[model samples]
Target: MRYHTVIAWAAAAGLLAGAAGRGYLAPLLPPDEGHGAWYASRAAGISAYLFLWLSLAGGLLMSSAWFDGLVNRARLLAAHQAFAIAGLALGLVHALVLIPDGWTDFGPADLFIPFASYYERADAALGTIALYLFAIVTFSFWFRGAIGPATWRWVHRASFVAYLAALWHGIRIGTDTGALPVAVLYLLTSSLLIGALTVRLVYVRPRRQAPARPPSRAAAEPAG
Candidate 1:
């Protein structure tokens, strides 16, 4: 759960950077009048930022799968689902905002498919895939009982895919891609997540052999 906390905090920071301050509060910065063509790129940046934040928060909540506490797990999963929906919603906002201009500018094809589209198509494509994956996994939880444990588990595994894509989406398009702060944050959070899982994999494994106690001559003599 400590790991989860890390994910949540990181995600919150990312979201606020792109959504809370970047998008809504475009305060005193000089306007980029020359880069008028980069509107789609800007929108993609906002979406990717928000998506990473939501995914981080969701990931923190998801680390509860290892918990033995039922109520706690449920609470965390609920939070995870909620943030994922927020990510999806923001992604749609990103897409919709582009619609009015994308068609006339780059033709309709670039908006849906990736790589072949406009400048920001990569991030947009990743966001779209992550959104669909989030929807499937989130919705499947409601039918958990009907699907039974195995199938439900498989469905939920899609969460990781969504998370990875969302993270990649953000890193690939963020204006701060090369910034020291962003790089430090990304490396620190990623290392923390991977490190914790590694510790569990190595140090937390079940004991396979009894500790070797020296064969004491005294104990052997006493037994005789």
Candidate 2:
């Protein structure tokens, strides 16, 4: 528990630092136009997407039977969980950083509520929805015992919906989307996720039925 808490704090600090360093916060020194927050917002948004991709990939890899021998399942699971928590932290920073961005100022409602943003309303909505879905799936771990395995499993499945929403959010609102490298990155990650899901579904074995029992000796004798 301490370890996880430490990791969480570290990730949060790193994300905030990265975002702030990139220009998400107002500049300490006077600038020509004070676009510090704008630059930071863009950088943080892209960074959040990258972390999300890592989390998604890790989750898929953890679910993959193919890695059963190649890697330690427990370690992989830990890594997967770490990636998800980190991604969520970065994602939150990505959204919150925009709040101070004077150029594209967003409030709490604009960040959390769907269709509340005057600019890119649909795109912002997608991201907001995705963030909520991610929060539900990620935090469900803590309450899994209370919710029960079946319900928790179902909630975890919502990660897929979150993934799709995030993908669309990036494509629709990402500043670097038009770049060749960024486009390829999105395409590759999406393909990998699809392939992993396909393999997991197709390669899993069907359960075998128990063999039928023979008739009792007494019944056979009675027949005779």
Estimate TM-scores for all models: 0.58, 0.77
- Candidate 1: where is the Cα deviation over 4 Å? 1-19, 22-74, 102-109, 114-124, 174-176, 180-185, 195-224
lDDT of 1 at 10: 40
Cα-based lDDT at residue 220, candidate 1: 71
Query: Model 1 shows how many backbone clashes?
Result: 0
Q: After superposition, how far is residue 99 of candidate 1 from its true place, in Å?
A: 1.7
The residue-level lDDT of candidate 1 at 194 comes to 62
Predicted candidate 1 versus true structure: per-residue lDDT over 23-130, tens digit per residue: 664552337565433454455445444454455444543453444344466555545555555555555555555556533354446555656666677775776677
Most lDDT-accurate candidate: 2
In model 2, which regions exceed 4 Å deviation? 1-34, 205-224
Q: What RMSD does each model have against the real structure?
A: 8.1, 6.8
Writing each residue's lDDT as its tens digit, candidate 2 over 96-200 gives: 877877777689998888999887999989998988898898778879999999999899889899989998998999776887766887898889888888877
TM-score of 1: 0.58
Report the C-alpha displacement of residue 3, candidate 1, in angstroms. 26
